[model samples]
Target chain A: MGNFLLVTIQVDLYDRLALNLEADLVQMVNKTGAKGVLIDISAVSIVDSFMGRIIGNIASMSKILDAETVVVGMQPAVAITLIELGLPLKGVQTALNVERGMDLLKTMIDESPIEDEQEYPEDDPFAQ
Target chain B: MILSLSKDNIEVVREQDVVLLRNRVKEVAVKIKMGLLNQTKLITAASELVRNMLRYGNGGTCLIEVVSRGRDNGVRLTFSDQGPGIADIGQAMRDGFSTGKSLGLGLPGSKRLVNEFDIKSKVGEGTTVMILKWANG
Candidate 1:
């Protein structure tokens, strides 16, 4: 809530809803300038390849916007299904639950290197 | 060696039908006492295939059946679409090969989630896919 945005998916999302969430979540990240985003899907019972791609897309988009994403509370069955679906959710970080996910997001945000602009000045020979 | 205990048909005509199909599959899975993991797998596979029917097939019909072989029980689903049939089913079954804006895991991925899978299609005709999941598998 401080520098992070938290979203909990409590329903079995349909295709259209999942797509809308992907769009809205990315927009929210841009609008709020949140450092980290947590998506809690514990209540979600299934993660088809489509949903899997949406999660991956969200994480990648958030990364491009300078925000880290952590997907949390995935059911064990859903995890197994995703792997079998050949969607390993690459590039997306996961946590056991929301609390751990928040901690992971904090660590990710804290450990990330500062912007290069602040570390290098125009007058510096290496600033190119 | 499989006997059909009960059968029903679901018409997949719109986006909402996909959701209805999944719920019906879930109901059948639970009726047969399918394990949670297996139920989830069955429902997910149903979701993928039904969406394929709606997207590529321009909607279709799904047949739900409860089947049994010896002491084993399972749910069998048949999705038939009148849309343009696949030109190359072999290519379609390969992972990451989609003609649509998707991850391309619908065919092959659904195959992995169930116990048995079969597909039939003819270019310009239509496509039909059948899948079965053993309750205990």
Candidate 2:
């Protein structure tokens, strides 16, 4: 079993470049065996469709890593834009702030039983 | 009164023209109090249309007009380009449909952002795309 890891991304309000962030988040989730990730976009005043897609992609990939993804600090306007654009964020959790997200993650970790004995057979094609 | 702004045949078909078009759209959007989010949507849709005209049509003119339909008040933008017109307007409207390496979100995605959309094209003549978005009263 992999050890728990935590990663945080602080999004800027006007930063337009997002492909790099998306790739990095996916890579980190795959490499760190993280239990969860917190994406803080409190500073972002706008969430364009391109940026929305990247965040959605990150959430989808993190699910494959068995890591939960939490979005923090989404401005009200950004949430409306996401809804208007029809970006699917069904499985992702959201919080009003990073502190709240951390508290929620901690609770989820404590209440959930650790799966230390889950093992894959050798030569399994899907084994990482 | 509705005002008209057009680019010279050569000047109209450029990526920078998108910026000019967006500015005009913003001006009209503000006059009607469309809110920031609605303005952004109009800008995004306009940018995509302008880019398509510049890249595919080699150059084209855009028209911006204000309109009021019953209780709805909004801006209408029409982009007309005289280049090798699209042979398949239906296919072009599909997501992931592109002649190049773009994400292919131009037509369909822009359509989603606007309240109303219309497109007319001729294979050899040219194409015109119209989009409308109303202010949220």
Candidate 3:
């Protein structure tokens, strides 16, 4: 199994399904030892606050497990709709397409500094 | 003259019904020859409001209609729920304000994706959100 999980949301997902997908993705990331997660949403035309939050949650959850996430292939209209909705998707990395997303993942994984310091707490040992 | 393609309301009582509502909205948008972008926006809005109905309104019904006024064709959606009505419609419409644990973009985001948006809620009664997206408008 590759160290990357690629998910292409092919439909306009309902609320429950999106939430399920987020759960599944996080579990999958842990099971597969995934170093990167790339979600392709070029086909997705719109995302509300709920959808936006799920997407953001996926990235955040994956990152917590030392995996980098990249969302790619956002349609122009979708981007505009998200912007107007005031959801900039802060802290989530985005790319133009799957191809570039893969490259970004490669770059991110290679240079990732989280793995080094994450396991070793920077706090003073006397505090414990 | 715009022939009546379809118009109806489906009860959204469960999770499966939310999916059904979105598909129904997509179907009506398709029948009206709505552009791909508009169709997506319509379906997205439908998904948002339908979920809102289920999560906040204790389940309800969504009215999906294909409307035409002269040369302009449109898809209209109306969601009504008999749940705890919003006490402050203005606060609910504001971005990033949520009573629940969400990004709180459901109402305002749905409003931005369509050509027309209207909301009416009476505390203790219920809430109704109506939207219209005209093709090529």
Candidate 4:
């Protein structure tokens, strides 16, 4: 079993910065053969479509590294906004809290493919 | 008009200032719908417009107004920049269309998020973007 990587981001939930975060997380997962990754966003009160896209992108990239990505502690308000915007979280798994995400990831690592079925679409409008 | 912030004809100068403006817009949007996920789209669009004013216009003021339009309450933000205007307004609106590396989704994405979008630009003059969105009521 590979080691787990936990990265916590405590920044304002904006677009450009979120893109930077996604890139960083993707790079970390690739660099370290971590079995799973847990993202903590309890500090963020708001999230937008651009940020959602970034999270979705990270989740998609994690699968390539054979690592599972899970988002933990998303605020209710932020979740609601994401639903309204139609921003699909795509390959990422989510837990009510970090502990739960860790448990879920552990289970997946032992059983089915830890990598999620959802893949990033090639024709994404926001593709850089 | 549920929320409106009018500056006494002053220009906003600074990158952080743009974030603040975006926060205010988000605040209003959140109030409209306690569970609105469009905050990301709204904030992204607002950031793009504000960035345009600060980068191209050098530093121009903006008036942000949120109104309840149609079935949903939407944000109506106007950014007026007094900088060198665009030569081709149509070309500027296209995606992957950026004056710099910062993802040119400013004009197009902002237009997409809102229900109504209007832009007026003139060469050697200035540019004004008016964006409107109706809440999902």
**TM-score of each prediction:** 0.94, 0.61, 0.86, 0.62
First chain TM-score for all predictions: 0.87, 0.69, 0.87, 0.79
lDDT: which candidate is best? 1
- Model 3 misplaced stretches (Cα beyond 4 Å): A43-46, A114-128, B1-6
- Candidate order (lDDT): 1, 3, 2, 4
lDDT of 4 by residue, B91-112 (tens): 8888657786554566776676
Q: Which ten residues in a row have the lowest lDDT in candidate 4 chain A?
A: A113-122
lDDT by residue for model 3 over B51-105, one digit each (tens)? 8888989998888778887888898888999999999999999987889987788
Candidate 3 matches the true fold with a TM-score of 0.86
Candidate number of the best DockQ: 1
* Per-residue lDDT of model 4, residues A1-128, tens digit only: 34778867786754457777878777877777687888888777555544666777787788778887889998785665555444546667899998898898888777664333334444566877
Error of 2 at B43 (Å): 3.9
Clashing pairs in model 2? B13-B59
Label model 1 with its docking quality class: medium
Q: Considering TM-score, which of the candidate structures 2 and 3 is the better prediction for this target?
A: 3
Put down candidate 1 lDDT per residue, A1-128, tens digits, no spaces: 99899999987888889999999999999999999999999989988888888899999999999999999999999999988878888899999988999999988887677545465585599856
Q: Which ten residues in a row have the lowest lDDT in candidate 3 chain A?
A: A119-128
User: Which model scores highest in TM-score?
Assistant: 1
